[model samples]
Target: MSGDGEEDASLEFTPTWIIAIVCTVIIFMSFFFERFLHYIGKVLKRKKNFALFEALLKVQEELMLLGFISLMLSVSQVSLQKTCIKESLMLRGLPCKRESPNSVSHVTFVRHYQTNFPLDFTGMRMLLASESGGSGHCKSMRDWKSWEAKIQQEDDTAEKMVKHVHELQFIKKRFKENKIFSWLHSFGKQFYGTITIDDYRAMRLGFIMMHYKDNPKFNFYKYMIRALETDFKKVVGISWYFWALVIVFLLLNINGWHAYFWISIVPFILLFIVGSKLEHIISNLATKVVDQNAIAIGNCVVIPSDDLFWFKSPKLVLFFIHYILFQNAFDIAYFFWILTTYSFGSCIMGKKAYIIPRLVFSGIIQVVCGYSTLPLYAIVSHMGSRYKKAILPHHMHETFDQWLANAKTNKLKREETSNEGTVDKFWGAWNRKKASNKTEVVAKLEEEMQEVQHEPVPEIEIGIHN
Candidate 1:
């Protein structure tokens, strides 16, 4: 056991630089591409908006893209390694039993998950239920119960109102049903009615195709394009700066520093051009393309306190590592493997394979493994901002600040007008206990008074007879 413990510790501490190298190239290239997007956006907003520097940023963006893609493809040429069971990349898959002298296995999905990954309140159910937390949800059933405790703790009228508001917000954002998942349920309801690692495996584009058989109102292609556009923005928009920081951090643990010197040059140059310029451009573009989604899904009745921002950091961190990293790693691995199963993609499935896998999967692996999680999150911020139109009814929609302010106003009026209900309203157990105690005291006093009122006449008659 001791020997096994030491071995496990050793493996955990061993940094995977190959992952860093791949991610560095993707994000480094993405930074410049996004800068070009920003430039284009700026010119559209107004030509005088940094037109002189546009040529330079464009040239830089182009060069980095070329260099990064070349290097990434080269890395994929490394000696044969085992592919994840979830992935079906031609060079690494089981069908390709023959080992190639030059090929990269990369990290497998199962192996990455074996590492002790973490998540949060929103993500707790999966983690606690994963075989990580013992017998999974079968044992404790803690996920749904955790929220019950939180709700009960909030006793006051105002606090309870806010709690209700936050719950609504949480549902809309965190526990949202996927379009594919919902569509599947609808299809099943139409006929049979039914519902992870093995979930999205065979069905590559999701159950959307099956859904098409039931009802085809939604343009799945348009929906995909929207999702992909958000991903593209994340990989190459103003979000690229976040990607740059991520690249530097990953590169820190890597061995061959000089190989990345040229790569680092452009990100270093990018720092100078960044200011309010890109921010302004992106904001304008967002007003058109993204903010509409935000409006559709904005329902929070409690304005967060300014100090809550600090605490939200940790929550956001857990959310990322859990939902995005863990779930996506498996989902994307499955997606990549399915390419071989696709009608035209069957050529890459079996042995005698000569094809080189694309770095697109490599990029997906890095983010899914929590490498560039923050930056990738920054890029896809808009997608997270919006929800399906049917999610929350318009009447139910209320901003946190709006609801909070209204609650405060009502609370103040009630407090000033009469103090009668304040104790019952705000206090949870203490007020109940107090009311019970008072009732007991009153009943005891009344019993004593009745005894006194009746006892004297009987006693006086007895004394007179004696």
Candidate 2:
């Protein structure tokens, strides 16, 4: 009886059979729990929690992968399951027209899309015919068309309806002509013509906005405040040091305080290099781009005042230099002050009101740099004014009229010169120069130049003609 019982137990539960049973139960439980959660409407709430749960979910994925690897290692047996999947996908191709019955066609023909509007007639007809059998609505539209013809014999309803259809067609034609598709293709090769310097300025601002818009870590205003605080601290500290050095020389009867003077050299050199670099970045990357846009739009030059620069210059060079360097130095000077105070601690190293020469120098640098920006602004304004004049409506009209006059004058001059055997041959030299070269080389050069100059025009046809 014991042997028989052991044999029956072996038959009921082999290792492979136990493993398969466990796998089936585990798979079924996973599917059941997933469906249960979805049925309880927890899936939508879980999806909405993605932003908060992103990090946790990623860690879970990694942990799950590790767990699976460990499980495979521990288990000698492996199993594979296969399933079939089907899905629908939408794809774009050339637009095609669907065929309609004679009655449907007549109703569609009378409802033109150009001028007068019909309320969802096409949409309704299409939906009804597609969903339900077209037997009913199709017959109704046909009967309406015949009835409309008979009504037209005694009333102006038919004529009015026909006019409405014609107007609808006109509207459709106009809309098709001005479609976004046409605009893109038509201006494909005209980038330079449409994009001006003002556009570039706007683009520069856009780039800045895109980079910093949603980033909480980078606050431009806070950075500026830090810069300003750094500058102020340096200014006050340098003032205190200068007076302290004077007092030391008097109290100790020291004839020459060479050590103090020498120590000052290190700070000056460091501040100069750092300040210059900071100034360059600000002026070139930030201020210059903005000013360039303003100049382009207004057509005037802007000049910076002497406040922005350390050196005073003549008007002409100052105009160009100020625009180039004013904002850069102001920005750099701020950063320099911060570095000196935090890194060197030279500004606040001495007694209060001691007048440190280094501090005074920093202040002088800031004042000079700040003042110089004024003149650069003026120069920018001037250039911007000139640009404005060039593109202004009335001014442009005058310029165009003048251009026409100049063209006429040139034509007259050319005609007069032609009679005197003077063709003003521009290509004569090039032709002579190329005459000795290989025909293929000359032809190739000509072909290349032509290709460079050629602008392709888009072909547009209205209605079904194209």
Candidate 3:
């Protein structure tokens, strides 16, 4: 019986090489899948609104990267659990049980058992329950009651911890709701309400470009045009070949032809290299076109040149990096927490098939929520605008003030001219109607109205506005 058990354990254990290969394949598939989606979008001409489509694509790429990272972490944890279990059983001179890496249940088992009852023999017995025992690893059926009771205790403790964390978050929320913070929040809200998210993004991008304006090789307009044009042309030309290769890989994967999957991936690898070369060639051509027609092309797009001084500040750049890092750290932690909780629940419920779908859904929600809150965060934090006046050079500040004053004056002049035109049109229409009857009183009124229209309108000084 012991020999049979050993044989079963050996058969059940997944080889390390297989795990590594599977992980590699998964990562490759994710990359190709994203590329495939972009190709489809291009082929369908869904990129008519280039900026918005590009932003969406960026979010999709980030989500894919996050999922890849999470997968790696989960696999590492599983491998660690497997190693620890095998070592523990070997040291105790016990027969190895059936070990498999098909589920993430070991994460919960290892966390609870290893941390709380490291020296307890029964903890090891319970952990072995995660190994292919179908929830009955103990010697007798009576121990099942004890197992349930212990698990319930652990769940209760976890719930308490979660509740404590929520309380802290509540306190933080209340602090933000205080008078001063609330006032600042409202101010930021108003500022952002005046400028849309897309406009804000464009402003930031323009700032970046202006900061690098001194670099001869970095023309923002040319680079943008090149990227857009290159992607479109490349997608149209190579999409069919890319999809065909992907389909071949999929067929191999589905048919259980594992060895052929690697062979099939070779074609994709070659195609990627060739496509990249083609893209570079196309980009060069597009850049030349942009250079030759710089003025005409530049006129078609609104390039943000104002507030360039604000973005060029080194401190502002550092702060932007800091905020982005902090946001990403929080996002990563939240993603892992969701996965861990989902894994724990799924283990108890004995449903493991939903992990992938849950992961994808969670990623989408995280991306959406992150983007939706980013504008608010930037506004409330007063991220880059707070120190603009203090950090700006004296010359630049003066220049901006002068430009602003001129703009206000021009705007007022235009408004006055428009108002005068309206009066002239109204009087001219009345005079034309009366001229048909040759009324002397109407003719006298027209002369007076023409004199009033000719007089200069008083200029009311416009106040400074944001």
Candidate 4:
């Protein structure tokens, strides 16, 4: 019984299965929830307050973006933590071995007896020292206190260095804000017509909203309508097949197979299938409409409406789907990797301390990764098309140029108005009083001249009549 108890204690918390199950459930729930929202939107469209539907769609998009960012942060945090822990152990000459070197499994710390060591920097140092042949032993409590003080001094120095770096950055920013630099910046913006990735994204979003507004039937309502009209058995069969695939993948994941790769690859296949279907739909619609109405620009055909709808709607949807699915696979793989690289029984900092750093690191990673890749992706995706000659009611380049011209004109007008107001204000009440007196004198002189002319004319008219 004692031996059995010992064995039970030896086994640490391995929550890989839980992570796998939760991720799977989240994926399915998110899909069904989206469908449910679409149904609600359909109902709302019949009401006067259809703005609620638009708000709901915006919220959903924002939430998806937030979720992706969160997932990315989590992956980065875990990866960084794992690296820190491994390096700390190695530095102390401790043995860190995984239970299964080739697969996702828990790590084991060999020749270590302490199970409740703290995860803070000092605690980690002490724990590792103890493990490295009684190096944690000191002559007295005073020695331990001294050692802690030394660590604290080092931490204070590090903090001071960080503060110094921040000061330098602030100084650099102030220097860049000088009049000469500011003028150069404005000049560059005027010359280049400052467009950015965010501008493109905003434009794309506007186009999507316009597309949905123009073609209400081309949305999720169509799918719902089809589902309602289809044979119940066929719908059931399709659903069952989908669920079966999901279950098979989940089982594979549980068995420690390369399920994530399969999951990630499946989205690409679906993207291809969906892309072909969308192309067919678009082609059929094209046949029905006049060629003159649709303008082919680059790789996309823009449909003329109140606003241009870049006709890559299907591709856009497929890209989002693929991105989400790939993210899920990446998250699952990262969790498994982290778990396999670190021993669950090992001491770690309290949740609050651990989480704060992770959050900060995640934010840094998100900003770096987002800015580095997003613009490049946007530019590359929109590059090179054979159909640039199609004349349209409004061209993007012309619109942008007009907007830039208008902005510059408005800025100049504002500056001139401000300068005139400043000059008027500088003269204070003197300028206003002088102007008012001048106007009054002119009015009095005109009145006097008018009276004199009227009196002479009356006498002259009477003599002529006699």
TM-score of every candidate: 0.20, 0.16, 0.23, 0.22
lDDT of 3 by residue, 173-211 (tens): 222324455445433432222223233233333334444
| Alpha carbon lDDT of each predicted model | 0.34, 0.34, 0.37, 0.37
Ranking by TM-score: 3, 4, 1, 2
Q: What tens digits encode model 4's per-residue C-alpha lDDT throughout 1-466?
A: 2356535444254356766897899999989978997887888667523334544554455456546655675566446435534534433422233344445323333212122211112222222112211211112223323433443344322322222211332122212324455445433332231223222222232233444445322222222222222211121121234435544543444222334444544443443333333222222222322234333222122232311113643224324432433333333333333344444343221134343443343333233223322222222222212111111122444587799999999999999999999888878778888999999999999999999988854444445554
Candidate numbers, best lDDT first, in rank order: 3, 4, 2, 1
Candidate number with the higher lDDT (2 or 3): 3
In model 2, the runs with Cα more than 4 Å from the true position are 1-207, 213-257, 282-466
Top TM-score: which candidate number? Answer: 3
lDDT of 1 by residue, 108-207 (tens): 3332322212111112222212211122122122322343344335443342222332234222322213545533332222211010111111111122
Q: Report clash pairs, candidate 3.
A: none
Q: What is residue 165's positional error in candidate 3, in angstroms?
A: 55
Candidate 4 clashing pairs, residues 3+ apart or interchain: none
Off by over 4 Å in 3: 1-40, 43-47, 51-64, 82-109, 112-311, 314-466
